[model samples]
Target: MIKVLLNGCSGKMGEVVVNASKNFPNIEIVAGIDKFPTEKYNFKVFKNTSDVDIYYDVLIDFSRPEALVDLLNFSVKNNKPIILCSTGYSDEDLKLIKEKSNIIPIFKSANMSLGINLINSLLKKIVPNLYENYDIEIIEKHHNQKVDSPSGTAILLADTIKNSLPIESKYVFGRDGFSKREKNEIGIHAVRGGSIVGEHDIIFAGSGEIIELSHTALSREVFAVGALKAAEYMADMFYPRIYNMEDLLGI
Candidate 1:
């Protein structure tokens, strides 16, 4: 069995993961870490990773970016692999994660949905062919409670396209009173309302045709399932490195 230490145990995604992991009998959530501890959970939940005393084979994080430092330190000290599902990490945080990956295996992804990662792989193949004539724009929607604008998945898609393009491309997030859309720019727009699970649309406009690649997450379970899969993948990994969806999916 793969024993998992779940972070953000009281959050929405954490709840979803808790519910979903029941189907995988081989995986067990031994303990959790959350700022707001509750008595309802079957497993013990602590306020922080430092307080955790349970034995876990891997760590799964779906919390905020602020938890990165402590998470990395604990994982490194314990020599345990971690699957980070949190978004909105700053460049410095990413650098720290990457540096620490030299000591312990770290799996990170902006979007944990397998469909989103597959869409990313599809974007890489098609963006290069259409980059010259197509004008690309990305639209993303999430729950109103989401703190970050232009969801990390949106940025991931934009980066996928940007990296595949022949020339340099700049990102313009939600333009207001813009003179005109630049030729070498990728426009990203965000919508937040109600309880949207998640939605991402990549629009490619050309003179005669428009091609759109879209993915709608009906529920958070998809991410929970993917994160568990990542947790399983990380459990057996002894190598110290930063891994992503590409590594998980073997893309």
Candidate 2:
């Protein structure tokens, strides 16, 4: 079995992961780390990485970006692989992740759902064929309690589309005071409402026709399942490098 040390154990996603782990008998969450650390779990919970004394094959984080440093430190110190599922990481934090990846295996993904990752792969293939004539826009919605705006998954999709475009395109978050939509602009909009698991829509508009691709996450279990799969994959990754869904799915 792959023993996992789950980060952000008290959070919503963490709870989802705990419940999802039951479906994967080979993956076991032996311990957890949470700032609050008040919730009762079947496994041991620690307030910080320093307080952890349990044995785990890998660390799976669904925590906040603020916990990145401590988590990375703990992973490196213990020579354990880590899977980072947190979003909204700053550029500096990304750099740090990449830096630490040179010493220990680090798996990171803004969104872990298989459908979302498949959409990312699809955009790479589909965007290049239509970007020249199609004006693109991305709409993403999440729960009100979500901390970040224009979620990491939204950015990931936008970045994928941008890379596939031949012409230089810039991102426009929202069109509040904008007079007109520029030809080389990719619009991104964020919507927050009540208890939305997640929703993403990618729109491509042309002279007379429009095309849309979308993915709706019915529940958080999709992500939890993917993260657990990542944990199982990372369990034996002794090499030092950064991995992602592409690596996990072999796409």
lDDT of 2 by residue, 1-251 (tens): 98999999898899999999999989888999898884578888998888999999999999889999999999999999999999999999999999999999999999999999999999999998998788999999999999999999999999999999888989999889848999999999999999999999999999999999999999999999999999989999999999999999999
lDDT of 1 by residue, 1-251 (tens): 99999999999899999999999999999999999997778999999777999999999999999999999999999999999999999999999998999999999999999999999999989998998888999999999999998899999999999999989889998989948988999999999999999999999999999999999999999999999999988998999999999998999
Clashing residue pairs, backbone N/CA/C < 3 A, model 1: none
| RMSD, every candidate, angstroms | 0.8, 0.9
Give the Å error, residue 66, model 2: 0.4
Candidate 1 lands at a TM-score of: 0.98
Give model 2 RMSD, 1 decimal.
0.9
Regions of model 1 farther than 4 Å from truth: none
| Model 2 CA deviation exceeding 4 Å by range | none
Worst 10 residues of 1 by lDDT: 173-182
